[model samples]
Target: MSGLEGCWSAPGQVRGKDATSVLRGEWHLGRRYFVLHLRSVAPAQAYEAAITYRAGEKPGGIGSFWMDTFGGLYEPSLGLGAVSPDGFYLDYHFPDAAYHNRFERRGKGWRWTIVERAPGKPDKLFARYELAPASCRGTTFTF
Candidate 1:
């Protein structure tokens, strides 16, 4: 997860609206888990989340827990995924909704995509972010 151990920033779209995001990642808990902190920089109602990823039950798999400003009240907060050559993919499932999230290397940076699926609804794009290396200074969130 060292590839993700730095600061990243991106101007992207979230929930079909313009948004800017800053992300910081580090290893914690004796290097047992990789924690990522994400903060929305633009838009008055900023979205924030803390996600922790660790080795999953299966080899080369990842298990994650997510806590966000939404408080998990409206979505599933747990994810199961597998590591790919470039990055990883996680699937979040709940009674009412399911999401497929992808993070992959793109050139020297990364791209994160989120797609949402709901019952009786067509799949929809939730967010797409292309992140590049950024300075940690002045980042709003403290790790």
Candidate 2:
């Protein structure tokens, strides 16, 4: 998981609106879990999240615990994922919808995308970010 341990900055779209985000990945629990902290810097919506990923039952599989500003305090947002060629993919199910999120390397940077699927509606893009290595200095968002 060394590839994921770093600071990153992304400029992309969230729900079709322009947005920017800062992300930092760090190992926690004595390396038992990799926690990713994200903060949105644009759109004035103040979105933030911390996603923790751990080894799954199957080899090379991953399980995630997602907590975000939009999630209910009592709700549990879990996901199952598998390691892919470039990065990985996670599928999360919510009460009203499901989301497929992918993080993959593209050239020198990375691309993170989320697609939403709901009953009676077509799959739609929820967020897409092009991430690049960034300095961790002076960032307000912390673990």
Clashing residue pairs for model 2: none
Candidate 1 Cα outliers beyond 4 Å, as residue runs: 72-76
Backbone clash tally for model 2? 0
For candidate 1, the per-residue lDDT at 107 reads 89
TM-score of each: 0.91, 0.92
What is the lDDT for 58 in model 1?
92
| Model 1: ten consecutive residues of lowest lDDT | 67-76
Which candidate number maximizes TM-score? 2
- Kindly list the per-residue Cα lDDT of model 2 for residues 1-143, writing each as its tens digit: 56768998989998999889998989988999999889998757788899999989999899998888887853458999999999999999887899999999888778999999999999999999999999999876644
Task: Rate residue 68 of model 1 by lDDT.
Answer: 82
**Candidate No. with top lDDT:** 2
